[model samples]
Target: MIDFYKYQGTGNDFILIDNSKDDFKANKVDYAIKWCDRKFGIGADGLIFIEPSTKGDFLMDFYNPDGSQSFCGNGSRCSVAFAKFLGIIKDQTNFEAIDGMHQAVISDKHVKIEMQQYGAIESIGNDHFIDTGSPHYVAYRNGVNENIVEYGKSIRYSDRFKTKGTNVNLIAEKGDRNIEIWTYERGVEAETLACGTGATACGISFAQKHNIDKGIIEVKAQGGHLRIHLEASKNDKVYQNIWLEGPAEFVFKGVIEDEN
Candidate 1:
């Protein structure tokens, strides 16, 4: 039997397991593929493992539904909340991920995470590309009536990103400080409720295109809403101090008796 927790951040759900004692010995990739199956298993966008961290409060190991390593934005926030539940962290904590170290603050209702810095965004044709922990292709999309899956997949598997692949996001500016985004995550290979990194990328990219240096943008996704704050260097093209803020909730807790 195994114990697990279900957590979600703005509808980006994950199956979390405490492996501090190395209790899980099964093949992680195979297990993720099985348990993340929507119909057959726990059914989540991804899986997260919490292990003791010598570098910080804990280590967040994130895997995509396809069993690939990833640094998920929403999943990372959920990990911070999970660490608090396990009594390993307080309101504010730092954790190491596949990408690097990250800091987060847990309030009474929301989790705000400091994301890594990003370099200049590359503009190709009508699209833009940036790596916000994960690679994302951003395009300004107008209106809501379109085939998201087909359009996103075409860009996701394009020859330019055939090597590592990239997440696809279609965004439309709604107001001066608000935008609506739809993301087709690379790992999930489909449109999800929301994507943290994708939202962050879109916000920053939009700011750059508009020549805005620093500000906050409200991103509305299918799952929920997220706030992305960005600061850019006037002399340099790099963007820094990016923050992603949203809600993280505990859905349920359970144990799996079938060790299959």
Candidate 2:
């Protein structure tokens, strides 16, 4: 039996396994697909293994709900919690991701993740294009009808976003300093309450388009509220310290025998 812990950041949940011994690396895809099943299994956005590493604090091996390899922002937040739970690292740690090395700090109520900024900013009509670990196309306007389940997925899986697949978001400018966003994730292929990387990408797009100089922005998602801090350089290089601040709790801890 493999022991695991479950954690969620703004509704993007994950099943965490302490594969610190490196004995559980095999059969990752099949394990993720089965363990992440909604009805028959624990139901999660992905499965993460905190593998023991000599290079970084720990290596987070993340798998999407469909058993595909995908980098996740919110899932990384949970990875921080899992690492802390297992006493693998201190309150702060360095992590290795598919995109690059990442730094995450665990606070009392939230996890602060230091991520790479937008690589490219393009305009697709009113939408904005950016890559925050993962590629995202941001479309922000007023009166989106709030039926994000249909609306977000249409873009999330549309040809433009489909070939490689992209996460879609609809943002409503609630206040000058506040924004409300609804997200449709690619791997999950559904409108989840919140998306960490999506929030960061959208926030950067909004800041750039508006030519605003604010560093802190409050982002409200369908699941919860989080804050983003933006830092940009004179040469137009964007750097960000985004905090997906919310309650992350240990929902359950148990073990399951490998069926395969």
Question: How do all models score by TM-score?
Answer: 0.96, 0.92
Deviation in Å, model 2, residue 120 alpha carbon? 1.9
Off by over 4 Å in 1: none
Question: Per-prediction RMSD in angstroms?
Answer: 1.3, 1.9
Error of 1 at 142 (Å): 1.8
Q: What is the lDDT of residue 182 in candidate 2?
A: 84
Report model 1's TM-score to 2 decimal places: 0.96
Worst window of 10 by summed lDDT in candidate 1: 230-239
Which digits, one per residue and each the tens of the lDDT, describe model 2 over residues 1-260? 77889888877788998888888755888888888989988888889988876668988889988887767788888888888888988889988877778888888857887767656577788778788878787887677776776876677667766778888788889877689888888877787878888888877877877676658768888878877777665634365454444556577888887642
TM-score of 2: 0.92
Query: What lDDT score belongs to each candidate, Candidate 1 first?
Result: 0.89, 0.79
Against the hidden true structure, what lDDT does model 2 obtain?
0.79
Worst 10 residues of 2 by lDDT: 235-244
For residues 28-132, write the lDDT of model 1, one tens digit per residue: 898789889899999999999998788988899999999999789999999999999999889999899999899999998699999975567888887889889
